[model samples]
Target: MSGARYWRHQDQRYNMAGNECGVCGSRFFPGKTMCPNCHRRSVGKMKKFYFNGNGKIITYTIIHEGSLQYRNQVPYLLAIIELEEGDKVLGQIVDCEASDLAMGKKVEMVFRKLGEQGKSGTIQYGYKFILK
Candidate 1:
Protein backbone atom coordinates (compact mmCIF):
# COMPACT_ATOMS: atom_id res chain seq x y z
CA MET A 1 0.00 0.00 0.00
CA SER A 2 1.05 3.60 -0.54
CA GLY A 3 2.35 5.59 2.40
CA ALA A 4 -0.62 7.94 2.35
CA ARG A 5 -3.14 5.11 2.19
CA TYR A 6 -1.45 3.23 5.02
CA TRP A 7 -1.48 6.29 7.25
CA ARG A 8 -5.08 7.05 6.36
CA HIS A 9 -6.08 3.64 7.73
CA GLN A 10 -3.95 3.71 10.84
CA ASP A 11 -6.96 3.85 13.14
CA GLN A 12 -8.54 0.76 11.59
CA ARG A 13 -5.27 -1.17 11.36
CA TYR A 14 -4.31 -0.39 14.91
CA ASN A 15 -7.53 -0.09 16.85
CA MET A 16 -10.21 -2.24 15.25
CA ALA A 17 -12.04 1.01 14.72
CA GLY A 18 -15.35 0.70 12.90
CA ASN A 19 -18.67 2.48 12.73
CA GLU A 20 -22.16 1.96 14.05
CA CYS A 21 -25.52 2.92 12.71
CA GLY A 22 -27.12 5.21 15.21
CA VAL A 23 -30.50 4.49 13.69
CA CYS A 24 -30.56 0.71 14.21
CA GLY A 25 -27.64 0.03 16.53
CA SER A 26 -25.91 -2.02 13.81
CA ARG A 27 -22.13 -1.88 13.65
CA PHE A 28 -19.53 -2.47 10.96
CA PHE A 29 -15.81 -2.87 10.83
CA PRO A 30 -13.60 -0.69 8.67
CA GLY A 31 -16.45 1.71 9.34
CA LYS A 32 -19.22 2.70 6.98
CA THR A 33 -20.54 6.06 5.86
CA MET A 34 -24.08 4.71 5.64
CA CYS A 35 -25.89 1.81 7.21
CA PRO A 36 -26.89 -1.00 4.89
CA ASN A 37 -29.99 -1.63 6.96
CA CYS A 38 -31.12 1.93 7.55
CA HIS A 39 -29.87 3.29 4.22
CA ARG A 40 -31.25 6.80 3.72
CA ARG A 41 -32.00 7.36 7.38
CA SER A 42 -28.47 6.36 8.29
CA VAL A 43 -26.78 8.78 5.91
CA GLY A 44 -25.96 11.17 8.71
CA LYS A 45 -26.27 8.80 11.64
CA MET A 46 -23.11 6.73 11.33
CA LYS A 47 -20.89 7.04 14.38
CA LYS A 48 -17.36 5.83 15.09
CA PHE A 49 -17.11 2.57 17.06
CA TYR A 50 -14.09 0.89 18.56
CA PHE A 51 -14.04 -2.88 18.93
CA ASN A 52 -12.64 -4.41 22.13
CA GLY A 53 -10.80 -7.11 20.13
CA ASN A 54 -12.32 -10.00 22.00
CA GLY A 55 -13.85 -12.67 19.78
CA LYS A 56 -14.37 -16.34 18.98
CA ILE A 57 -13.10 -18.30 16.04
CA ILE A 58 -15.95 -19.08 13.67
CA THR A 59 -13.77 -21.08 11.25
CA TYR A 60 -10.10 -21.39 10.49
CA THR A 61 -7.53 -22.75 8.04
CA ILE A 62 -3.94 -23.81 8.21
CA ILE A 63 -1.82 -22.27 5.48
CA HIS A 64 0.65 -24.71 4.02
CA GLU A 65 1.82 -22.10 1.57
CA GLY A 66 1.66 -18.33 1.54
CA SER A 67 2.32 -15.52 -0.86
CA LEU A 68 5.79 -14.10 -1.43
CA GLN A 69 5.40 -11.44 1.21
CA TYR A 70 4.27 -14.03 3.71
CA ARG A 71 6.09 -17.16 2.58
CA ASN A 72 8.11 -17.09 5.74
CA GLN A 73 4.93 -17.45 7.70
CA VAL A 74 3.68 -20.51 5.91
CA PRO A 75 1.78 -22.99 8.06
CA TYR A 76 0.33 -20.15 10.07
CA LEU A 77 -3.26 -20.04 11.22
CA LEU A 78 -5.91 -17.76 9.77
CA ALA A 79 -9.48 -17.53 10.94
CA ILE A 80 -12.76 -15.74 10.63
CA ILE A 81 -13.39 -14.38 14.07
CA GLU A 82 -16.76 -13.22 15.30
CA LEU A 83 -16.08 -10.26 17.50
CA GLU A 84 -18.12 -9.75 20.64
CA GLU A 85 -19.89 -6.89 18.86
CA GLY A 86 -21.04 -9.39 16.20
CA ASP A 87 -18.86 -8.29 13.30
CA LYS A 88 -16.81 -11.10 11.81
CA VAL A 89 -13.21 -10.26 10.99
CA LEU A 90 -10.51 -12.24 9.14
CA GLY A 91 -7.15 -12.21 10.87
CA GLN A 92 -4.12 -14.34 11.60
CA ILE A 93 -3.99 -16.47 14.73
CA VAL A 94 -0.67 -16.46 16.53
CA ASP A 95 1.10 -17.80 19.61
CA CYS A 96 -0.40 -21.27 19.38
CA GLU A 97 -0.49 -24.44 17.36
CA ALA A 98 -3.18 -25.62 14.99
CA SER A 99 -4.20 -28.29 17.49
CA ASP A 100 -5.21 -25.58 19.89
CA LEU A 101 -7.89 -23.98 17.71
CA ALA A 102 -11.47 -24.96 16.97
CA MET A 103 -14.77 -23.41 16.10
CA GLY A 104 -16.14 -21.20 18.90
CA LYS A 105 -12.72 -21.01 20.57
CA LYS A 106 -12.20 -17.64 22.23
CA VAL A 107 -9.44 -15.34 21.03
CA GLU A 108 -8.15 -11.86 21.75
CA MET A 109 -6.35 -9.35 19.59
CA VAL A 110 -2.70 -8.45 19.84
CA PHE A 111 -0.68 -5.92 17.89
CA ARG A 112 2.13 -7.35 15.81
CA LYS A 113 4.26 -6.81 12.74
CA LEU A 114 2.59 -7.64 9.44
CA GLY A 115 5.53 -7.02 7.14
CA GLU A 116 7.87 -4.42 5.72
CA GLN A 117 7.43 -2.51 2.47
CA GLY A 118 10.99 -3.28 1.42
CA LYS A 119 14.47 -3.68 2.77
CA SER A 120 14.48 -0.10 3.97
CA GLY A 121 10.85 0.81 3.56
CA THR A 122 8.14 1.30 6.09
CA ILE A 123 7.09 -1.57 8.33
CA GLN A 124 3.46 -2.52 8.58
CA TYR A 125 1.78 -3.36 11.85
CA GLY A 126 -1.71 -4.70 12.55
CA TYR A 127 -3.82 -6.80 14.90
CA LYS A 128 -3.52 -10.59 15.10
CA PHE A 129 -5.51 -12.92 17.32
CA ILE A 130 -4.29 -15.33 19.98
CA LEU A 131 -6.13 -18.02 21.89
CA LYS A 132 -7.56 -16.67 25.11
Candidate 2:
Protein backbone atom coordinates (compact mmCIF):
# COMPACT_ATOMS: atom_id res chain seq x y z
CA MET A 1 0.00 0.00 0.00
CA SER A 2 1.11 3.56 -0.49
CA GLY A 3 2.12 5.64 2.52
CA ALA A 4 -0.83 7.97 2.19
CA ARG A 5 -3.34 5.17 1.93
CA TYR A 6 -1.79 3.27 4.80
CA TRP A 7 -2.06 6.24 7.14
CA ARG A 8 -5.56 7.02 5.91
CA HIS A 9 -6.83 3.68 7.18
CA GLN A 10 -5.01 3.69 10.51
CA ASP A 11 -8.22 3.69 12.53
CA GLN A 12 -9.57 0.68 10.69
CA ARG A 13 -6.28 -1.21 10.74
CA TYR A 14 -5.65 -0.57 14.41
CA ASN A 15 -9.01 -0.09 16.06
CA MET A 16 -11.40 -2.23 14.04
CA ALA A 17 -13.31 0.91 13.15
CA GLY A 18 -16.02 0.03 10.71
CA ASN A 19 -19.54 1.19 10.00
CA GLU A 20 -22.85 0.18 11.47
CA CYS A 21 -26.12 0.60 9.67
CA GLY A 22 -28.42 3.03 11.43
CA VAL A 23 -31.43 1.41 9.79
CA CYS A 24 -30.85 -2.30 10.44
CA GLY A 25 -27.98 -2.15 12.95
CA SER A 26 -25.82 -4.32 10.76
CA ARG A 27 -22.05 -3.87 11.18
CA PHE A 28 -19.26 -4.20 8.67
CA PHE A 29 -15.51 -4.17 8.78
CA PRO A 30 -13.78 -2.14 6.07
CA GLY A 31 -17.09 -0.36 6.41
CA LYS A 32 -19.22 -0.03 3.38
CA THR A 33 -20.90 3.14 2.16
CA MET A 34 -24.27 1.36 2.43
CA CYS A 35 -25.59 -1.57 4.43
CA PRO A 36 -26.10 -4.81 2.62
CA ASN A 37 -29.13 -5.61 4.72
CA CYS A 38 -30.93 -2.31 4.81
CA HIS A 39 -29.88 -1.16 1.33
CA ARG A 40 -31.50 2.16 0.44
CA ARG A 41 -32.55 2.87 4.00
CA SER A 42 -28.96 2.55 5.13
CA VAL A 43 -27.49 4.92 2.59
CA GLY A 44 -26.10 8.08 4.18
CA LYS A 45 -27.01 6.67 7.58
CA MET A 46 -23.98 4.51 8.32
CA LYS A 47 -22.27 5.34 11.58
CA LYS A 48 -18.74 4.66 12.69
CA PHE A 49 -18.28 1.92 15.25
CA TYR A 50 -15.18 0.71 16.98
CA PHE A 51 -15.00 -2.97 17.76
CA ASN A 52 -13.81 -4.09 21.19
CA GLY A 53 -11.34 -6.45 19.54
CA ASN A 54 -12.40 -9.62 21.30
CA GLY A 55 -13.22 -12.76 19.38
CA LYS A 56 -12.89 -16.51 19.03
CA ILE A 57 -11.04 -18.45 16.39
CA ILE A 58 -13.45 -20.03 13.93
CA THR A 59 -10.74 -21.72 11.89
CA TYR A 60 -7.02 -21.30 11.16
CA THR A 61 -4.09 -22.56 9.18
CA ILE A 62 -0.35 -22.55 9.72
CA ILE A 63 1.19 -20.85 6.72
CA HIS A 64 4.53 -22.33 5.83
CA GLU A 65 4.78 -20.42 2.60
CA GLY A 66 4.14 -16.79 1.73
CA SER A 67 5.19 -13.88 -0.44
CA LEU A 68 8.47 -12.04 0.10
CA GLN A 69 6.79 -9.45 2.24
CA TYR A 70 5.70 -12.14 4.72
CA ARG A 71 8.58 -14.56 4.30
CA ASN A 72 9.87 -14.01 7.81
CA GLN A 73 6.51 -14.81 9.21
CA VAL A 74 6.33 -18.20 7.58
CA PRO A 75 4.78 -20.87 9.77
CA TYR A 76 2.69 -18.20 11.38
CA LEU A 77 -1.01 -18.64 12.04
CA LEU A 78 -3.72 -17.06 9.92
CA ALA A 79 -7.27 -17.29 11.18
CA ILE A 80 -10.86 -16.31 10.72
CA ILE A 81 -12.05 -14.73 13.94
CA GLU A 82 -15.71 -14.42 14.83
CA LEU A 83 -16.01 -11.14 16.69
CA GLU A 84 -18.32 -10.75 19.65
CA GLU A 85 -20.46 -8.43 17.54
CA GLY A 86 -20.95 -11.12 14.88
CA ASP A 87 -18.53 -9.90 12.21
CA LYS A 88 -15.91 -12.37 11.07
CA VAL A 89 -12.44 -10.97 10.26
CA LEU A 90 -9.21 -12.37 8.97
CA GLY A 91 -5.99 -11.63 10.85
CA GLN A 92 -2.69 -13.07 11.86
CA ILE A 93 -2.37 -14.99 15.11
CA VAL A 94 0.69 -13.91 17.03
CA ASP A 95 2.41 -14.55 20.38
CA CYS A 96 1.02 -18.10 20.59
CA GLU A 97 1.98 -21.52 19.46
CA ALA A 98 0.12 -23.62 16.94
CA SER A 99 -0.16 -26.45 19.47
CA ASP A 100 -1.94 -24.15 21.87
CA LEU A 101 -4.68 -23.04 19.45
CA ALA A 102 -7.94 -24.77 18.66
CA MET A 103 -11.34 -24.08 17.19
CA GLY A 104 -13.21 -21.63 19.40
CA LYS A 105 -10.07 -20.56 21.28
CA LYS A 106 -10.46 -17.04 22.60
CA VAL A 107 -8.33 -14.32 21.09
CA GLU A 108 -7.91 -10.55 21.35
CA MET A 109 -6.60 -8.02 18.89
CA VAL A 110 -3.28 -6.20 19.18
CA PHE A 111 -1.53 -3.60 17.06
CA ARG A 112 1.51 -4.76 15.13
CA LYS A 113 3.60 -3.86 12.12
CA LEU A 114 2.09 -5.32 9.01
CA GLY A 115 5.10 -4.67 6.76
CA GLU A 116 6.94 -1.86 5.06
CA GLN A 117 5.61 -0.45 1.82
CA GLY A 118 9.04 -0.44 0.19
CA LYS A 119 12.64 0.37 0.95
CA SER A 120 12.59 3.24 3.45
CA GLY A 121 8.83 3.52 3.00
CA THR A 122 6.30 3.83 5.77
CA ILE A 123 5.98 0.99 8.26
CA GLN A 124 2.42 -0.23 8.03
CA TYR A 125 0.61 -0.88 11.29
CA GLY A 126 -2.38 -3.14 11.75
CA TYR A 127 -4.10 -5.55 14.11
CA LYS A 128 -3.26 -9.13 14.89
CA PHE A 129 -4.72 -11.41 17.53
CA ILE A 130 -3.34 -13.56 20.31
CA LEU A 131 -4.73 -16.38 22.39
CA LYS A 132 -6.35 -15.24 25.58
Candidate 3:
Protein backbone atom coordinates (compact mmCIF):
# COMPACT_ATOMS: atom_id res chain seq x y z
CA MET A 1 0.00 0.00 0.00
CA SER A 2 1.00 3.63 -0.36
CA GLY A 3 2.90 5.23 2.48
CA ALA A 4 0.23 7.85 3.04
CA ARG A 5 -2.61 5.42 3.53
CA TYR A 6 -0.52 2.95 5.50
CA TRP A 7 0.61 5.57 7.98
CA ARG A 8 -2.87 6.99 8.28
CA HIS A 9 -4.19 3.71 9.68
CA GLN A 10 -1.12 2.63 11.58
CA ASP A 11 -2.62 3.38 14.94
CA GLN A 12 -5.87 1.54 14.44
CA ARG A 13 -4.25 -1.42 12.74
CA TYR A 14 -1.38 -1.85 15.14
CA ASN A 15 -2.92 -0.96 18.45
CA MET A 16 -6.52 -2.00 18.04
CA ALA A 17 -7.41 1.58 18.77
CA GLY A 18 -11.11 2.24 18.83
CA ASN A 19 -13.65 4.62 20.25
CA GLU A 20 -16.13 4.28 23.06
CA CYS A 21 -19.47 6.02 23.03
CA GLY A 22 -19.89 8.26 26.02
CA VAL A 23 -23.63 8.04 25.81
CA CYS A 24 -23.94 4.27 25.99
CA GLY A 25 -20.38 3.24 26.89
CA SER A 26 -20.28 0.92 23.90
CA ARG A 27 -16.86 0.46 22.37
CA PHE A 28 -16.10 -0.07 18.71
CA PHE A 29 -13.01 -1.24 16.91
CA PRO A 30 -11.25 0.70 14.11
CA GLY A 31 -12.87 3.74 15.61
CA LYS A 32 -16.24 5.20 14.79
CA THR A 33 -17.38 8.74 14.16
CA MET A 34 -20.77 8.07 15.66
CA CYS A 35 -21.86 5.37 18.04
CA PRO A 36 -24.12 2.79 16.44
CA ASN A 37 -26.15 2.38 19.59
CA CYS A 38 -26.70 6.05 20.33
CA HIS A 39 -26.56 7.23 16.75
CA ARG A 40 -25.83 10.98 16.31
CA ARG A 41 -26.39 11.80 19.94
CA SER A 42 -22.90 10.49 20.64
CA VAL A 43 -21.28 12.08 17.64
CA GLY A 44 -18.76 14.19 19.50
CA LYS A 45 -18.97 12.27 22.75
CA MET A 46 -16.72 9.46 21.69
CA LYS A 47 -13.56 8.73 23.66
CA LYS A 48 -10.44 6.93 22.58
CA PHE A 49 -10.38 3.26 23.59
CA TYR A 50 -7.42 0.95 23.34
CA PHE A 51 -8.25 -2.74 23.40
CA ASN A 52 -6.22 -5.33 25.30
CA GLY A 53 -6.61 -7.68 22.31
CA ASN A 54 -7.97 -10.57 24.34
CA GLY A 55 -10.91 -12.17 22.62
CA LYS A 56 -12.54 -15.32 21.28
CA ILE A 57 -12.93 -16.61 17.76
CA ILE A 58 -16.57 -16.49 16.79
CA THR A 59 -16.14 -17.91 13.32
CA TYR A 60 -13.44 -18.46 10.73
CA THR A 61 -12.56 -19.73 7.27
CA ILE A 62 -9.54 -20.69 5.24
CA ILE A 63 -9.21 -18.82 1.98
CA HIS A 64 -7.72 -20.55 -1.03
CA GLU A 65 -8.30 -17.54 -3.27
CA GLY A 66 -6.49 -14.33 -2.45
CA SER A 67 -5.68 -10.91 -3.82
CA LEU A 68 -2.56 -10.14 -5.82
CA GLN A 69 -0.73 -9.05 -2.72
CA TYR A 70 -1.70 -12.20 -0.85
CA ARG A 71 -1.43 -14.70 -3.66
CA ASN A 72 1.50 -16.48 -2.08
CA GLN A 73 -0.27 -16.62 1.25
CA VAL A 74 -3.30 -18.52 0.08
CA PRO A 75 -5.17 -20.75 2.54
CA TYR A 76 -4.67 -18.16 5.28
CA LEU A 77 -7.15 -18.21 8.11
CA LEU A 78 -9.54 -15.30 8.57
CA ALA A 79 -11.63 -14.98 11.68
CA ILE A 80 -14.11 -12.79 13.41
CA ILE A 81 -13.03 -12.25 17.00
CA GLU A 82 -15.30 -11.04 19.72
CA LEU A 83 -13.32 -8.91 22.13
CA GLU A 84 -13.79 -8.93 25.87
CA GLU A 85 -15.26 -5.47 25.57
CA GLY A 86 -18.13 -6.91 23.54
CA ASP A 87 -16.85 -5.61 20.24
CA LYS A 88 -16.03 -7.81 17.27
CA VAL A 89 -13.24 -7.31 14.74
CA LEU A 90 -12.22 -9.20 11.62
CA GLY A 91 -8.54 -10.10 11.32
CA GLN A 92 -6.24 -12.76 10.00
CA ILE A 93 -5.21 -15.67 12.19
CA VAL A 94 -1.52 -16.44 12.07
CA ASP A 95 1.18 -18.38 13.93
CA CYS A 96 -1.16 -21.36 14.13
CA GLU A 97 -2.50 -24.16 12.01
CA ALA A 98 -5.95 -24.29 10.49
CA SER A 99 -6.72 -27.56 12.24
CA ASP A 100 -6.29 -25.88 15.59
CA LEU A 101 -9.01 -23.30 14.99
CA ALA A 102 -12.44 -23.73 16.49
CA MET A 103 -15.44 -21.67 17.51
CA GLY A 104 -15.11 -19.84 20.84
CA LYS A 105 -11.40 -20.44 20.96
CA LYS A 106 -9.40 -17.86 22.91
CA VAL A 107 -7.14 -15.54 20.96
CA GLU A 108 -4.76 -12.67 21.45
CA MET A 109 -3.80 -9.85 19.16
CA VAL A 110 -0.42 -9.64 17.49
CA PHE A 111 1.35 -7.13 15.28
CA ARG A 112 2.57 -8.39 11.92
CA LYS A 113 3.70 -7.13 8.56
CA LEU A 114 0.79 -7.04 6.15
CA GLY A 115 2.98 -6.56 3.10
CA GLU A 116 5.48 -4.24 1.50
CA GLN A 117 5.63 -2.16 -1.65
CA GLY A 118 8.44 -3.39 -3.84
CA LYS A 119 11.81 -2.62 -2.29
CA SER A 120 11.51 0.87 -0.85
CA GLY A 121 7.92 1.97 -0.84
CA THR A 122 6.63 1.01 2.60
CA ILE A 123 6.18 -1.96 4.94
CA GLN A 124 2.64 -2.12 6.17
CA TYR A 125 1.98 -3.43 9.68
CA GLY A 126 -1.33 -4.66 11.03
CA TYR A 127 -2.87 -6.80 13.76
CA LYS A 128 -3.53 -10.50 13.59
CA PHE A 129 -4.82 -12.98 16.12
CA ILE A 130 -3.42 -16.21 17.49
CA LEU A 131 -4.62 -18.86 19.85
CA LYS A 132 -4.05 -17.98 23.44
Question: Which candidate has the highest lDDT of all?
Answer: 3
- Model 3 / residue 14 / CA error / Å: 7.2
Model 1 residue 20 distance off true place after TM-score fit, in angstroms: 0.8
Instruction: Please identify model 3 stretches exceeding 4 Å from their true place.
Output: 1-14
Note each model's CA RMSD in angstroms. Answer: 3.5, 3.2, 3.4
Error of 1 at 74 (Å): 0.4
Clash number by candidate, in order: 0, 0, 0
Judged by whole-model lDDT over C-alpha atoms, candidate 2 comes out at: 0.85
Q: Which one wins by TM-score: 1 or 2?
A: 2
Ranking by TM-score: 3, 2, 1
Q: How well does candidate 2 score on lDDT at residue 34?
A: 91
Q: Provide the TM-score for each candidate, comma-separated.
A: 0.84, 0.85, 0.87
For model 2, how does the per-residue alpha-carbon lDDT over 33-120 read when each residue is reduced to its tens digit? 9988888888899999888888999999999998787898888999999988758899999998899999999999887778877676
Candidate 1 on 1-132: residue-level lDDT in tens? 775457656664346788889999998876889988899999988988888889999999999989886799989999999999857889999999999999999999877778878665676777799999
Angstrom error of the Cα, residue 17, model 2: value is 1.1
Q: lDDT at 132 for candidate 2?
A: 89
Better of 1 and 3 by TM-score: 3
Best by TM-score: 3
